[model samples]
Target chain A: MDDRPGAPRQNASEEIEALITLMAKLPGLGPRSARRAVLHLVKKRALLMTPLADAMHNVAASARECLVCGNISGAEVCHICRNEKRATGEICVVEDVADLWAMERAQVFGGRYHVLGGTLSALDSIGPEDLRIPKLVQRVADEGVSEVILALGATVDGQTTAHYIADALEGTGARLTSLAQGVPIGGELDYLDDGTITAALRARRSF
Target chain B: MDDRPGAPRQNASEEIEALITLMAKLPGLGPRSARRAVLHLVKKRALLMTPLADAMHNVAASARECLVCGNISGAEVCHICRNEKRATGEICVVEDVADLWAMERAQVFGGRYHVLGGTLSALDSIGPEDLRIPKLVQRVADEGVSEVILALGATVDGQTTAHYIADALEGTGARLTSLAQGVPIGGELDYLDDGTITAALRARRSF
Candidate 1:
């Protein structure tokens, strides 16, 4: 018997094993935790367990990704893409679907989003074509998008991707903006570098 | 036009609304977060979304409560109940199935579990019948269980339920043993009341 981390237990059903495998892949969870979680969901079938399972099934049957902006949807285009009111000549570009949703939860941005799936990573052999950069450029022209807000992370890859996108959209006459840096977010001001502080200070306008 | 939190936009579907409603009820999730989670799942259908949904549907269709111990199951009795190896002389009793699973994760005990479902609570109109006390007693005799280990919480209702079960099982030839109480379990021990401390001390024996 192999002693690998999260190895499948002997004599378990394929379905149960599959559940354990998938659950183990979830963030902050492992094989042991997955087993425990699956057991729990199975036990609370009427109240919590069933509903969660039903939700998973319904989503499985209907879920699809929006080809235009990389947002997940039940159809070819997501609800955000279908909404004419959201087409406000501005596109907020994000690094991941989760980040896009986080922005949506704030309810401050009235414009729609374009998910990049991930930032530029030379180490990972990821190039511009690997991301949704081409589609974003196509959207700028087709949708008459005026402003592109870069909501990438502060990481090197995130900055590189933001710059790459900024350069790509230069000919389209679309203004590029990014989320502010060097702010004491969640009370972690002490972690800021001098470069970040300097860049934030230089970028500071009237606001 | 209600001002309540998490009110969906007028264009959202009833199914989507229902999904959002149920998602909102989940632990660590609220209405706004639920909306975002649903959106993310729907979009990632082929990868992150569809499989999750499929798993949910399968579980939902087959899930049922174990008639014997109130554990979640896909049949008349749970896997624990069906397993012959688990029919040891000792039964580890718990306030809920979650607690039962916690003990299982620890893997110290080889005996079966008795899920009381919940603790005794006067504030919520809960009583012995509201729990699985009667079923537990019956099982002790029917299964020839020699020892009944009480692994309930140290809360007021938890202690009350434990004592109630101890009294009910008197002279049934089943030795009742509660989990130790000296340690600051579920919290630091200094926070416990003097009466609880005294009782725990009196109940203490040679390890």
Candidate 2:
């Protein structure tokens, strides 16, 4: 009778409660919404549901972080790192793999990617070691990367991280450039359309 | 160099590419957007990334469908259906379990629910068996039901399903009612805000 599942409980199955709890934890989905999503998935089991479950299961089982770029992968090296044709002298530096994928979808960037994971934030006490900065530097040297394109956020911390990376790679002989200032502050590259990303890449400025 | 992974024979370690591909398949996410999401999750590994991964893994392993009402439940039956207090001699019959959960969020519907799975769509060749209509009928008889409230969509298919059920239950002593006609055509109950749902429930009409 008590709507609260936390109450000394009734005859409910533990698995059902567990499923609801997990669905409730998802972004934009609360306990109520999670219940709805679960219901929808079950009813449409043949079309949308089964495929989604399989995808989730497969991804969950095989997913791992890329050692080189912190990108999601099924194996050790991410696809971007393994691809030979994508190994242009240019390496597009992004704060996240999502941005890298966005670039790839636009089909403009022929080069590889360096996912920084996140920008330096003093408030968050996040430093270079917390991200993939060290690996990025090593990649430039090990891969003969000629240019490091910075497609980071315009936030203060993002700018600060960019400057730090530029300083660290000063003698690496790789041309350091950044996406144009056109990217608004705290504006994630994910929200930008293909044209905007292209323009930003085309009008890159020297760091 | 070639960004495409599943396109041909190659090593399967392309984590970034795999992540991007998987992400691209998410609802409201394309190849480009999935890439961005993966990148962001990787960057915020500690704060956002790790937590999300753990959550996904947990849900992936345990999530399942409820046997009774067809809601997402970790166990055989959903929490709502198991609670004795929820057995208020009234059952709100909805086209989908999502509708049931939406009603729950309003904290107005104290009774149990019957998830029909979907409306009877002739064009789609969806019949009573195709949905959980038979199950709903069985539940009404088994649960000592008083009122069978229909919270179906305003679409033609939804109306057809409602009429079919009403006709089927015509001789039954239980009363048949439906949510007000104010609900828009082809409108999903999930998209409506709480107030609208409350109004619709309060202004319900006889079938």
Q: Which of the numbered candidates is closest to the native, going by highest TM-score?
A: 1
Clashing pairs in 1: A43-B72, A53-B56, A56-B53, A57-B53, A72-B43, A73-B43, B184-B189
Q: Which ten residues in a row have the lowest lDDT in candidate 1 chain B?
A: B1-10
Runs of candidate 2 with Cα error greater than 4 angstroms are A1-13, A23-33, A44-70, A79-88, A134-145, A180-207, B1-89, B104-112, B122-145, B154-160, B179-207
Instruction: Score candidate 1 by DockQ.
Output: 0.20
Highest lDDT: give the candidate number: 1
- TM per candidate comes to 0.75, 0.64
Candidate 2 docking classification: incorrect
Number of the top-ranking candidate, with DockQ as the measure? 1
Chain B TM-score for all candidates, comma-separated:
0.82, 0.79
Q: List model 2 lDDT by residue over B101-186, tens digit each.
A: 56765577778888787888878888788888888888888888899999888778888988999988877789998876456677
Report per-candidate DockQ.
0.20, 0.18
Q: Rate the local accuracy (lDDT) of all candidates.
A: 0.74, 0.69
